[model samples]
Target chain A: MKPENQTISPNQLFYLVSVFLLGSSVIFLPGAQAGSSAWLAVGLGALEGLIFLAIYNALVRQHPGKNLIEMNELVFGSFLGKVVSWLYLLFFLFVSAMLLRTFASFFAIIMTSTPLMVFLITPLVVSSFAVRSGLEVLARYSQIVLMTLVLLFCLESILLAQDMDPSNLLPFMDIPISEMLLAIQNVAAIPFGEAIVFLIFINLVSAPLEAGRFMRRSFLFSGILLVLYAVRTIAVLGTHSTISTYPAFAAVRIINIGEVFTRLEILLAVVFLSLGFVKGSVFYYGAVLGFSQLLKMRSHTPLILPIGALLLNISTLLFDEYIYDIIDANMLFPLYSMVFAFFLPLLTLIVAKIQKRRIQKGE
Target chain B: MLNVFLVIIAYILVGLFEAPGLIRNKYWRELSIVAVLLSSSLTLSLLLAMGVRLPMIIPVIYRAFVPLLTWLGIM
Candidate 1:
């Protein structure tokens, strides 16, 4: 709550952005994009993300030391501004739910047969506690988790090198151009575009000018890491990557250094849990912060539990009976997110600029 | 069947008790209720229209209130 007490260096901010974006997506993106051409999607997606980040940077520059909610009120009229701010809060909450559900479903499939809700509730409770501690703790926690994830990822990728077939990358770009573009849009909207949530905490950075540099570094680092993982998944699973529901998990399952290095998906699960925890905590924090701003509350700590409970309920309720609904979320939620996260914010920025210009001319 | 409903009830009760402390101002109390109700209704309608079955007990309550609320011209 004390901005002076919260001092996150530019390096830490970079690490937070990298880890938050890289998270669990690297494990599954190859399977989602599939085949030899997934890297093409990654390349295009990174470019789209950079453009989106530019728009965000412009917004940040225009409203130094203000989060999106405050800027919304400054830009739009009170009623419309509150609506937009609330929509963003809802978006953050929905994302938190989706990530929680995904992590839970993954555990249910690979790690345990216990009820998904039981596995999920533990993370939700933990994340609520983490968010209540405030942003500095979350940022520091992300740094530690990101380091562990990177170490484990490098070790796993190396161990799996034997199973990898370079031939799997052959015949690249075979997919239609349109499909590749669609994949780019998907990637942009997801892992890259969703990092727009960082805008909520941009004011917390020790150096605002370095935000662009830190964000770019985070995107490139995460982008490269994801591309490497995708390459590994393709090489290990070959054309079978498309068939496997969780190609990264399957790839990890296939790793065997003369049978001693088998079944390291457990290690991958640790990475997933760490990344998922950071992601959930960040969104949960954002939701609480946005709610506080909307109500003009001094702090969000007391509200954390109720919001966490609401999210827990919404997580369970949001999904349909079939897993296909979850997949449909992959298809639908990204577009919905773009409206609030990118398009709406951009509109607000334009309106703010116009209003400022009008006031200056009147003077 | 009964257990899940009970768990949900417990969750809602926890939320209701905490809500007052979250935003203590009178204006915020009214705003918070409106925000919760409108958002919940919007989500419920959207999910139902998508053909997702609401868990049985929740649907019964929603069905009862939704019509009554709609008839009163309140979302």
Candidate 2:
């Protein structure tokens, strides 16, 4: 069992949430489904993300100091709470698998020499090691690595300036309303919906109210970066945004700084690997903790390696080909994720409200 | 095959890494979870080593969900 003494301050929580939000989404760029309207979709996605964070923040405020699991237990009582908690764990497990697969599959497209397992297994093992060290280690690791990531992104964007033409973002907001709405649905589930895992970490905030503050800031910071990235990618890739498998990589690959420095895309490997590491480690830790909590175990470390291995296997075998999962994600995942993102939290909030009223009536 | 051998060695190393604490602490549930994990990993690894085509999760999930998904207007 991790001691309660392992509390991280709101400041650290802010960096952690920012890095977590920036994690896998940057590499994948889910808003490209909106075409030239991708930049607009990303902006709207940020607005939606703020709403999502507001719900999470409100939930945290209503039941200060209690994490998502404890909140479930309080709202639903022990037996049902554990069931809901188990479902959260299952969601964590599958989502971790989904992300691992996404990253690995992206690399598989780039390099064919390595067998698929080689890519899938490395991050899972590395993340298990990180999870075993506890949250303080993750927080410190993110603080340092996130600085490097930001610096690298700034450098890459500067180098790519010649290739990016703003005119490529023309015909903006021209997509059909239904298509834009669909893109929004898809965008919401990604990056932000994946953040449903944050519920596990928010309870560890020293002052529970500060958790909300840190998270809202993280949302905005990550939101701005994502929106800029989508616009930049669309500006460079133009009509290719709809077809480019890894648009960010494609956009970055063409950077030529006075003909002396080309293929700067190599540095992007850092972005992909590091951000994926942070994202994977977060979800992996969440799954391990949630699983142990579901089992009523006080310590999660003992289960880390096994769960990590299971995650590797599941993620490696997640799809026959990458595109099927991509399509499913765009199609069904929005609906699937809403069960967690909207319904579950909303249910908990409503039920908690009713219980509080009953208690006040008694008092 | 060399790959199968390496896979076995990896499982053994994982066992070596985990066994002592589990025994010292009498962590039966963890020991079981490790056992299941190692066995599954080895099974998949050995199959890959032998060049057997592995069945994927999507077909089953797609088959089962097509009706429900279609019904929900999400297919």
Candidate 3:
């Protein structure tokens, strides 16, 4: 990864971040508790995501050219920094594997006869190639993939418009306030807070100082798109959106435009696969790049496939019924995600600020 | 059993595909890391292919959080 030579444009950053934020969330629909009001939770989650992005950007501004691992070293000293970086490496790997498994399960729905390892290996192989080509390639790919997703999403929604009952969005406060808050927290932690990984790539942007603005814009873009998806799903599927494993796919299946546009669920699958690829490659790139940096290696290229193999192993064996239960347990998932996403980065920022103040006083 | 052979062969092909470049560059450290990662993942994958029940790490993470989430009444 040539960070200095290969700088990501603001638009590339926007597309990458937008696709990543909208990844598995499109299929799984985080914040199921919000029901028809899930769109509101996504809206609020984007607002909260801006605050999270602000903290990440502040960290970047504090250490202009340094990535998360390097910033940890500067702020916490080498030993503690290595420990924190290792934890983040694990987090990234876990996230990569989780995203891989999410899509594999979705694949299983379509290809029931196919073996699990096939689903796991194929994506990892593609993502390994993507990660090996480096971040710029991944960002370039996101632009095309995100555009396709948006177009397919719009076409499907328009086709389903006839079947949509706008009244389905009524009685918005169906869930209790506390549960609604939890649902909002789930939305924030997932697809939104997951943007914390972008901190690692912030310094790779053409103008690191302005990357935050791009990220904020992408968050708003992805948020509005997700809100539209939520509303469309609710409008098409009604209360059944909460129960369907894939509300978007089910709703797309309902798209019967004079039999010409019926059975449009394949469009949803294509959208999910493309979004998952972009998201997976980003996380995959983050893990390998960050680890290589931690190891003081010149290139992360060799590590890509090996780490990909590890991801394959994790995705294949780690995702079962019990793991699904844990992941679907909205309470645990959000709180657990916040530890790596919000808490650690905030702590690093505060400690860095305090250390800088002390140095100024000493000077 | 054949599926396991295919997997092993696939890994071998990947190793063959990548090793020459590393050897040419004399990136011995990278080669070693790649060797470690590939071998470990291969061992785990082969075990999985054979239906060997490997211990999972996620359950430990879940155990750590389950108690806390349960206490919050959000489980």
Candidate 4:
């Protein structure tokens, strides 16, 4: 089946976006550099993220029925467009590889005995299958995953309520405004602004025009979840949340309600992994679909496993230690991500608008 | 050795599963692309299994950004 023929509902789009947004960031806690003010950073970051989302949505609206790859071709002409598209394809693949690495590292920490490749291959294989099945299947799967994660997260949060120290969140925003701004930038760059990938899927929605609305709703939902997640980490782990690599998991690890709910970090792991799967699948599918479309291939199925293997290899090479991933997230990723997430999309939208005016004048 | 063998077998299985469908459809271009990607990935995976260290661009990129971030006082 041609991927273009597959369509998912707006609700499915919402679920997929929410799941993808929460993916690794939920466990990794994107704005931990802000210390006790991590939640505030995320809150401000969501506002900035909305601006990025609006740019992506405007670009999609400008080029309805066309993915970011196709829009590049139409806006920039064949040669330059192909170059831009290739860069974007690489960006998508790189993001997928990063997500895959994050997933593997998370599991590697908890399941210390399991080989890292096993964790990496598991999600890669599953995502390859989902990508080959087409976008509808992936979206439907995300719908189920997002619902389960929400229910479990709520249950876990209520169970950990007694463990939350309100004072941990006190003296908030005490950090230098510059550090706070950097943390906000970090949150905006990751999890939120990374929704630029959704531009690829916007064309896949049955209601393409309404895709932006659904995306906004998903952002609101995930933004709230992200703030709650940051607050939870700060409340539960307090100062340790700033230093803990996996703050969400560490917070949940302290859940010892009469020792009955001890080791609930396992539960958080399950939720994070599920979100990771959806996140990985979206990026994987976007990269493959974009590649096939860029090549003018009739189908993306044949490309799935081959690209998956490359992705697995790339993921392995991404970070030797988990600490590098954290450093990259804190220091480099925000700036590095901006080129693709903000600059390129903004450039595309402006050129598309200019071209549209020229065409209208010619008519 | 076993890890390398398993990596090879995994690549072979993936090839067998995907190549036949492309050949059946006579999707020559698609088949070629798949062959190129699969072979390259196989080589990379084999090297990885053999404990070879491949050069990574991420660190370089991270390094390149360090001065900019530090100058801005974000680092």
Q: Best candidate per lDDT, number?
A: 4
TM-score of 3: 0.95
- What does the lDDT read for residue A143 in candidate 3? 90
lDDT score for residue B62 of model 3: 71
Q: TM-score order of candidates, best first?
A: 4, 3, 2, 1
Which residue runs of candidate 1 sit more than 4 Å off their true CA positions? A1-7, B1-75
Q: Which regions of candidate 3 fall more than 4 Å away from where they truly are?
A: A1-5, A322-329
lDDT of 1 by residue, A1-363 (tens): 322236578888888888888776856753255257776677677778888888888888888877787788778878888998888888888788878877888777765658877877899989988886777887888888888888888898888877889988877888767566667777788788788778778877889877878898888888888878888888888878766777787889887887787888888777878887888888888887777768775556556766776777677775544444434444454455678657986798788889889999999
- Per-residue lDDT of model 3, residues B1-75, tens digit only: 986998899899879987998898888988888898899999988998788877665665777877887887777
Higher lDDT: candidate 2 or 4?
4
Q: Which portions of model 2 show Cα errors greater than 4 Å? A: A1-5, B1-5, B29-55, B63-75
Ten contiguous residues with the weakest lDDT in model 4 chain A: A1-10
* Model 3 lDDT, residue A120, Cα: 80
Candidate 1 at B51: error in angstroms?
Answer: 16
User: Candidates' lDDT values, in order?
Assistant: 0.73, 0.80, 0.84, 0.86
lDDT winner between candidates 2 and 3: 3
Candidate 3 accuracy as lDDT: 0.84
Which model scores highest in TM-score? Answer: 4
For candidate 4, the docking band is medium
TM-score of 4: 0.96
| Residue A329's lDDT in candidate 3 | 42
- Tens-digit lDDT track of model 4 for B1-75: 999999989998999998888898889999999999999989888998999887775776777787897899876
Residue-by-residue lDDT tens digits, candidate 2, A1-363: 443347788988888888888887776667777789887887788788788878888888898887899999999999999889888888888888988888788787779888878778877778888888888888888899788878888988888788888898898788778678777877777878778888987777788887788788888888888888888788888898778777888888888877888887767777778877888888898888777766765467767877776787677666777667866677767767888987898889899989999999999
Displacement of residue B1 (Cα, Å) in model 4 is 3.4
Ranking the candidates on lDDT from highest down gives 4, 3, 2, 1
